[model samples]
Target: MSNVKDVIVKLTDVEKEFDGVKVVKKLNLEVRKGEFLTLLGPSGCGKTTTLRMIAGFSNVTSGEIELEGRNVADLKPNERDVNTVFQSYALFPHMNVEDNIAFGLVEKKVPKAEIKERVAEMIKLVQLEGLEKRRPAQMSGGQKQRVAIARALINRPKVLLLDEPLGALDLKLRKQMQLELKHLQQKLGITFIYVTHDQEEALTMSDRIAVMNDGVMEQIGTPDEVYNRPKTKFVAGFVGESNILESYVTQVDEDLLHISLESGKALLHAPGFKNEEMIYICVRPENLLLSETKKEHFSIRGRIVEHVFAGSVIKTVVELINGQKLRVARHPNEEEFEVGTYVYVYWHPKKAIIVHTVEEQIYNVIEGTTNRIYEQLGEKYSPSAREDSHDQ
Candidate 1:
């Protein structure tokens, strides 16, 4: 857990609706002072709606939003001490870089000398010093984005909201701006609440991430926490590449669970599983290793189906005897295995995470059983709960 002494913004039971259709539902979040928190999800996941609610652009249907300890739900966008940088840049076409950056201060009736000084400082902060006289038509995509960012930061708002500001840039420029924005946030010590559908961007720049699906928050944690220890199945599939396997709990001994897969039985180290309970086992591609022979505890036989040569790693797809396919990632320097080669897919028992097997499913396997992990153990078996046991 992080040592969050002060919360700059908080959303409690926040909800939104459009034409009687619910978009954002019962969202609870905390943004710590000077922390970079990102709301990440795919399109129509309500990430933008959440950001808009925070920025006071969209009114909440119910619940409370507090900024710096004051309820800001009733405040207008400008009344709240926050600025937004949209994906479109939103810069004036006729105005040059300095004028566009100074426009906000001018609207606030700031003194002439102070506005000039602040504008100059912001220009240098965003590395736009040399492009002061360049119009939006003359500057590159990167420069125009810097100008948008400078314009927003000139007022020194308590929090900054960015709605996919890098979406319009080319791939190379977007990558460059991700690092630049992170460095600028650290230097300024301003709280940032960013919204993006790009998983890589969220993983690359966020101090923490709140992953949402269909207007509900799936999980919120550090980048490593969300990526490595996802609480829900949606997060596991959305954040990164995961090979999920369906299995039933056959036996349990302390923290070790004996699960029966379609191909065979395997032992996994996890908690909150009862006998005959059905669950999904999530394993990252990088965690699966290829071996010539099967291991004692956590191994399965599979036949190589395809091999993709990614620049830094080779992604190998293997089909199990049960007709389920799993992806394994290996370093590029490792010896390659050809298609149709028989091999054993193995991973450490601790590398697998057990998820609740729900209905409405048509992917990997059928729902065979159920255990009241949550109802029986209360919060102890909640989705956010994690087992401390590891392979010894």
Candidate 2:
């Protein structure tokens, strides 16, 4: 909730490699004070490696890491102003909850009275007041996790690093803990750098998400920004369900451009595209509309291959004449389309997002420059800008 723009942690051109294999490449990031920033990606995407580098568990191969504007590249784990809570909980099997929370302060040789007070405060902070006597073996997964967090926060570090701490819990407990963790971070006003591969968890808790892939940061923005306006094809496909259509520009009409499917069977309208240019268009499943009657523009004929009744919405798979398949999500209240039934799939031009192709993404990685496709589209065609235009 705090809007302070203070930079607590900065990673400048950070690179990490193991045995000549690069894991994190030219990564630049800044964690703002009192913000819940998540490093989100699939396994082996260098998210955990990045977090470990910040915590001083792993050394960076190149680049500098600064904590509170002071270079910490040479600092030891205990010397840095940060603490980490890992997925394994890392709670000592022989230690009780109170003892585990008090371990760090004890190591620091804090006075007995002060350590007791600090441990009590941490217990209340993590809502483990009544479980002080329980050991890791006696507590549930969620309880053990809280103990680990309390232990990490007991030091009052400038930043707290969490690497998939909730991954071991059941779905119901994980969802519950997500809200609790977000609320706790805001309450403590600590800069949290969380790492998770779960897209839903990242979206639910992060103020801003840094999406990484193959040793590079694909995108970093607020949840809505990354979800609605993904900068790359990988971001769009990985962050959520999307329908990617390959199309080529056919005609240009002032601000509006007409594009046709690669097979030249279906036509669509977009803003600010060049003629004869091939591009990828992304549309979220919920954005696609199904109609019995043809729409005025951007309408395609498809036969429903299957319809699934999810609790809140109906998911229908439609196949075009060219063999391209699209998944559509409709509100449960809408009429359902039976298999083999013909339907019109339509959407507004504003809902379509022009994203980078696989080749463009590769080129950007190789050249270390912004994609030319994005340069051509410009700021006016950006996801946020397009949303504003649609609202107007």
List lDDT for all candidates, in order: 0.88, 0.88
**Compared with the true structure, what per-residue lDDT tens digits does model 1 show for residues 308-375?**
98989899999999999999999988878889999888778899886543233323233222224444
Q: Mind sharing the TM-score for model 1?
A: 0.89
- Relative to the unseen true structure, what is the C-alpha lDDT of residue 243 in candidate 2, on a scale of 0 to 100? 93
* lDDT by residue (tens digit), candidate 2, 1-392: 22324888999999999999999999999889888999999999999999999999999999999998899978999999999999999889999999999999999999999999999999998899888899999999999999999999999998999999999999999999999999999999999999999999999999999999999998899999999999898899999899998878777877566777833333455665678988888999999887778766455778899888888988999998788899999888788777999888877777888899556867757644433444568977665565588798
Q: After superposition, how far is residue 177 of candidate 1 from its true place, in Å?
A: 0.9
Distance from true location, Cα of 199 in model 2, Å: 0.7
lDDT agreement of model 2 with the native:
0.88
List TM-scores for all candidates, in order: 0.89, 0.89
Backbone clash numbers for all candidates listed: 0, 0
